[model samples]
Target: SAVISQKPSRDICQRGTSLTIQCQVDSQVTMMFWYRQQPGQSLTLIATANQGSEATYESGFVIDKFPISRPNLTFSTLTVSNMSPEDSSIYLCSVGGGAGGTTRNEQFFGPGTRLTVL
Candidate 1:
């Protein structure tokens, strides 16, 4: 099991501004993923941060808009660039379980950082 933490449980930002959130893990992990949950919406994978490599973003996301950094095995950061009211959502960090030959892919999510744009 892995424990994760995210900064700014909630924030209100104006349009066209950006916010960078930090994520820390208790143990080393192979992949760290970012997600966004809008009001009354399902969680959506934003990107996957792999240490020593550039982040792999999901469709409709670009590095210029949602840059991610994984400096080490246990820490990462995600920045929401050029924000808009449409970008208001709860951001979450997740880590998958199981190691070595185990194929378990269970993901544990953070409490989430809720953002409201005005």
Candidate 2:
């Protein structure tokens, strides 16, 4: 199992402003994922970050709006470029265990940063 951390756990920002959320893991992980959850809704995959490569974003999400950086095996950052009411959601960071039958195969998530755009 991996432990994940996120910064600025919750914040209120103005429209058109941006916010950068940081994610750190306790151990090495092959892949790091970013997600967004609207109030009372399920998590939506935003992007995947792998060390040494550009992040792959989901459809409707772009690098310019949601840039991701994976600097090493246990750390990554995601930036929300322009804040909007629509972007006011819970952003999460997660890592999954692959090829293992243990809980490592399950995805462990950070405490998620809740953002509110005014």
Candidate 3:
């Protein structure tokens, strides 16, 4: 088990701007992922940040728009570029439990970065 933390729990951004959110896990995790949740909508997987490789973005999400960086297994950053009213949403960072288990693993999520684009 680990403690996951995100910075700037909530923020108000201007149009055409950008916000970078950081995620720190207490210990090395097997996997790290980023997600986005629109108002009144369910969570959408943004990408999976690899420890040493480029992040894998999901459909509809591009690297240029949502650049991710995972310097190590314990830290990652996600930048939401070119913000707009439609980009207003809660961004989340999650880390999977460490290895060495045969049972199902649970991913722990950070509080989340809430951005309201104006």
Residue pairs clashing in model 3 are none
lDDT of 2: 0.90
For candidate 2, list the clashing residue pairs, or say none: 97-104
Error of 3 at 103 (Å): 6.7
Give all candidates' CA lDDT scores.
Answer: 0.87, 0.90, 0.88
Q: Please provide, for model 1 over 1-118, each residue's C-alpha lDDT reduced to its tens digit, 9 standing for 90 to 100.
A: 7778899888999999999988888888878889999999999999998889999999999999999999998888899989999999999998884542223678766778999989
1-118: candidate 3 lDDT, tens digit per residue: 6678999899999999989999998887657889999999999999988788889899999999999989887899999999989999999998874532211377788999999999
Residue 11 in model 1: shift from native, Å?
0.6
Whose lDDT is higher: candidate 1's or candidate 3's? 3
Report residue 79 deviation for candidate 3 (angstroms): 0.2
Worst 10 residues of 3 by lDDT: 96-105
Candidate 2 colliding pairs, count: 1
lDDT of 3 at 107: 75
